[model samples]
Target: MVVMWMVTGGAGYIGAHVVQAFLDEGMAVVVLDDLSSGHAEFVPEGVPLVRGSILDTPLVEAALREHGVDGVVHLAGFKYAGVSVQRPLHTYAQNVTGTAHLLEAMDAAGVRRIVFSSSAAVYGTPDVDLVTERTPTAPESPYGESKLIGEWLLRDAARATADDDAPLRHTSLRYFNVVGSGRPDLYDSSPHNLFPLVIEALLAGRTPRINGTDYPTPDGTCVRDYVHVADLARSHVVAARALEAGTSLEPVYNLGSGDGVSVREIMTTMADVTGIAFEPDVAPRRPGDPARIVASGELAARDLDWRMRHSLTEMARSAWEARRQA
Candidate 1:
């Protein structure tokens, strides 16, 4: 009895890795993506790529039924935090409204489980050094607000259907900065991500610029937790397996590495991996940029088999190789 899971936004960078992780474990998967930010070529052959948005209840419900989907890994949405500030309505429409519609379709089609793709943006600039699951959520951007709302939707939906036969069982994984490549054929194509921004600049014969080199950190630069996309993807499968086996899980899990790497360190590593030795340009700090934001993945480690399998060097090298090949 092989369980079939539908991965929304599976054609994107992180989603593609998740799809591959499921397939690697001999589980079956299907992808539903609108190709707005996802690339069709990133989707592996032989896996059904349903071209649609999660907002379309009829379309999502049809796909769930037509494929006999037992669970869903919801990852589709407008994910840019900075841009979300300017386009709050669009962000809410896609993330909050889209999640609501997905849940509705899941209920209509009797899909009982889901693993939502959440973000660390839910905790906006925490004063603490290491973020835990219990940190207060104070989202600054519309993107973060939408994600928090998505989690609420899942929680409330589960509460509402608790007495039902197939009560909804779900968990939201709040991601930090997901980087690196699981496969060379698949790479991060986002223009906003730090890894890609640096890669793109180096490729075009330009120096990578580091924003805010005056923070109160070891290197006077912002420090952030960077997790390998593949590592993060593997945990999604573990969480789904737990749900399928009737194992109870927390409503939300933070997928973090409990380690902080400074922007200066990242630039140095990028230089080492790419074999481009040049100093990075220092620029003024971006507004609202926190000095550091790392998290303890102890809970996820205990429950979801989460671990940092790759080092900072591996992350930089893999990302550079994938981008170079692309």
Candidate 2:
């Protein structure tokens, strides 16, 4: 019998890439998304997509049963870190409460395994140059706090159901910056993310502005690990496969590039790759912006075959092509 997986928020950018990655491995995929931030076209043909929120327990549970879902890739949540600070309740409703509801549905349906799309925000501006799985979690925003809570919820659920025949096996992926595009039709549509913001500005014939050119980094700008979306997507599939085979895995993995690129370098690469020859305007740093925070992907590399396959130039070029197609 073939294994089937349900991808919540699979109509979004990262989720769409993850669906493709699973398809590449010959796993049957079904996507669940409310189309709030996700476009229906992003979902590939032939993959079953259910248009609904994960909070809708009956809807989520029905999708699982109807599709014979063996596992789930939970990716649906409100993800804007900055805006989450102002709208804490809304963030909690979507990420925290929504996660609780999904777990409830999973339990009701006896779904045994899940791969969660967590964020490095759980680390909340780490002090270490290379954050490990042991890094202390101190989320700075409601969004980060909600993701950390989601991780805890999964753990608690696993413990509660350990004695059952269908024990919950779960792993959360943590990363800082996700960029680039896997296909021409799919591109990052986030308003707050760096790559999309820059790409959109240039396309509108406006100069892209870089926040904080006076940070303590070598380039006097903030530095972050920007991983290619395709590479990140592949790791998600590997994690799912491991769970399907009843292989034991750590509770979490950081899909980070040990080293990182500064915002200035990103701008330069975009200019070179797209032949947009205008210099970016330098702006003051946003509040609570870290000077540098890159995590060690060693754990994920060992367990999930994770690695940064694309260079900065390649990431920029692919994203540019996708944006043009958008």
Per-residue CA lDDT of candidate 1, range 20-133, in tens? Answer: 999999999999999999999998999999999999999999999999999999999999887787789999999999999999999999999999999988998888988999
How many collisions between residues are there in candidate 2? 0
TM-score of each: 0.97, 0.98
Q: How accurate locally, in lDDT, is each candidate?
A: 0.93, 0.92
Error of 2 at 159 (Å): 0.5
Q: For residues 1-326, could you state the per-residue lDDT of candidate 2 as single tens digits? A: 99999999999999999999999988899999999999999999999989999889999999899999999999999998878888899999999999999999988888989999999889877778788899999888898899999999999999999999879999999987899999899899999899999999999999999998888789998899999999999999999999999999999999999988999999999999999898899887775466777899999999999999999999999999999988
Question: Alpha carbon lDDT of residue 204, candidate 2?
Answer: 92
Q: Which parts of model 2 are misplaced by more than 4 Å?
A: none
Clashing pairs in 2: none
